[model samples]
Target: MTDETQIMEINKPISKTVVAIKRIDYVDIAKGIGIVLVVMGHNDFALISPFAHKLIYSFHMPMFFFMSGMFFKPDLPFLMYARHRFNRVLKPFLFMILFIYFASISFSNVGIPQASRRLIKALYGNGHYLDWVQLWFLPHLFVVSLFAYFFFQAVYRRGLFPLRWVILSVLFIGGVLGITLFWPFEPDILGRGFTVFGLPFSLDLVFVSGFFSSWGMS
Candidate 1:
């Protein structure tokens, strides 16, 4: 190899870090329970007991979202988090979309024009069921985590957290009222409600799940 190649290799990022984390058994158990509930809710056998599925659906998302938020560090650098999200969420998202898209082209009547249009929409995340129903949650969770990181730093990092909780209690009531009245939109904060497959990074869910994310942060 040339000296230029050697220099480039030496400058490359090591791309690995070792950190010890204490595992909390109950948290894992709760997440596992939520996962089971999510599966059961989607299973066709669940049609036999709709109310049970409803109960599972009611709490499972919140439980899952809360668990996701619980480990967020308010102090982590944004670029670091972006890199993490790109690896964990965006990579999987792109891979799955490509896999599903190609599978469709192979098995279905998807012509070049149709497939290209589908690719555009899928990349933008502009559909309610973007290519597949299950994949939407990862991007939505990614978006909500972004909101939580900033919100936690702004509210909690400055010692305003205790008072903010009191204020948030009132706001939570208002949020519930608004949700009840206005079809799940939250007045388009920070101008991020732009549309894509369904909402870019699942923007609408950012507000709703943000509550859970912030709660977990606390």
Candidate 2:
């Protein structure tokens, strides 16, 4: 067989296979645009004018998270929910981690020992060490989804809580307090004031996320 014919024969699976799925054009398009804005803001934040960066920063994440919240199925069965989280969030998170490990060790010339240490740290919230600021969102999103799921199940789903909205308000207030109150709790190393990062599990902004996600339920 000719080289071109042989190549075509070998590529039959990809070339001939097709799969179709329904999609909502507006939602998908809006989300695509939102993602572009966010990526542009992050990637070229410094290069772009400060005002433009500020504009993107102001709206992009809120829009993204709000859309995410809008899709959360609070009433989903526990097993299905767990499997969905695993397939969607955990899989991407693990893949990002593996990619980071390779990039740090090879492209960044970091040693395995140091890279592994950073990998562990990155799993929680330390993306700065790996120079991977973006992946921090993945873990934080997973945690926030879990928080919303449990909260929804306990209060709204069960119908056992009376002042649920009031409780939400109180928690929101407390979350605000937590952001300002980080330094006092930041001290760790031998009682020295080392200070925690901007947020843990994105809890500094958990109030915002929680609000939107909860809003999605109603």
Candidate 3:
């Protein structure tokens, strides 16, 4: 009959329901498998087989993105999300880039002319060959994460059903088909120009699709 006792009784059912819902196990399994595969794929060891590499490349990173989307509920304010994202992504990207630049210079015997030219090209806009091989995923993943976060926020705000799997599938299919249709039959200036769009189409499509799919949207 007391106020405190009444409050406790009223909250008990809700708390128990939440506790029951929190015990889902599939998410943890998916995350564990994805992380293990990612680490194995990245490691420079003989343990990796071609089939394993292909499987990891196909699903591991995408699964990570999807898992991220599942938990993309921005509880903190927008400013907090922005600050966290900058610290987690942009700062590290800059530091790694600078580190790679200096490391290349320190280790390589390439003459000053060639190294300087390559450094200048990388700093300006022309992509570096080293970057093409090693750190390419960082920038691409950062962009995809930022996009997914903002997209999830918008979806939450609009009160839309997060079942966007069909929409994502359409985008993915359309993008692939469009790229295939415009595939260059011959090497030409314009043919090369079309290749630039390929990254956005393929990367973003996969990233967002994985996100939605992990959320049971697919």
Best by TM-score: 1
In model 2, the clashing pairs are none
TM-score against truth, every candidate: 0.75, 0.74, 0.58
C-alpha lDDT score of every prediction, in listed order: 0.73, 0.73, 0.57
Give candidate 1 misplaced runs (Cα > 4 Å): 1-22, 126-129, 167-198
20-97, model 2: which lDDT tens digit per residue? Answer: 877889879988999888778777575758888888887777676667777888668877987887688768877888
Which pairs clash inside model 1?
A: 125-196, 125-197, 126-196, 126-197, 126-198, 127-197, 127-198
Name the TM-score of candidate 3: 0.58
Better of 1 and 3 by lDDT: 1
Of 2 and 3, the candidate ahead on TM-score is 2
> Candidate 3 residues 1-218, lDDT tens each?
99999998988855344444574599988877877776788776326477767767777666766666666545777778767766776576567666766777789776667766765544322123335343554555555556666656666456664545554666566755554442322435955632332342235344445454335421
Q: Which tens-of-lDDT digit does each residue in 1-71 have in candidate 1?
A: 99999999999999878887988999989988987887887788467898887888888998888887788
- TM-score for model 2? 0.74
Whole-model lDDT, model 2: 0.73
Q: Which sections of candidate 2 miss by over 4 Å? A: 1-20, 45-47, 126-130, 158-170, 187-195, 198-200
Model 2 Cα displacement at 216 (Å)? 2.8
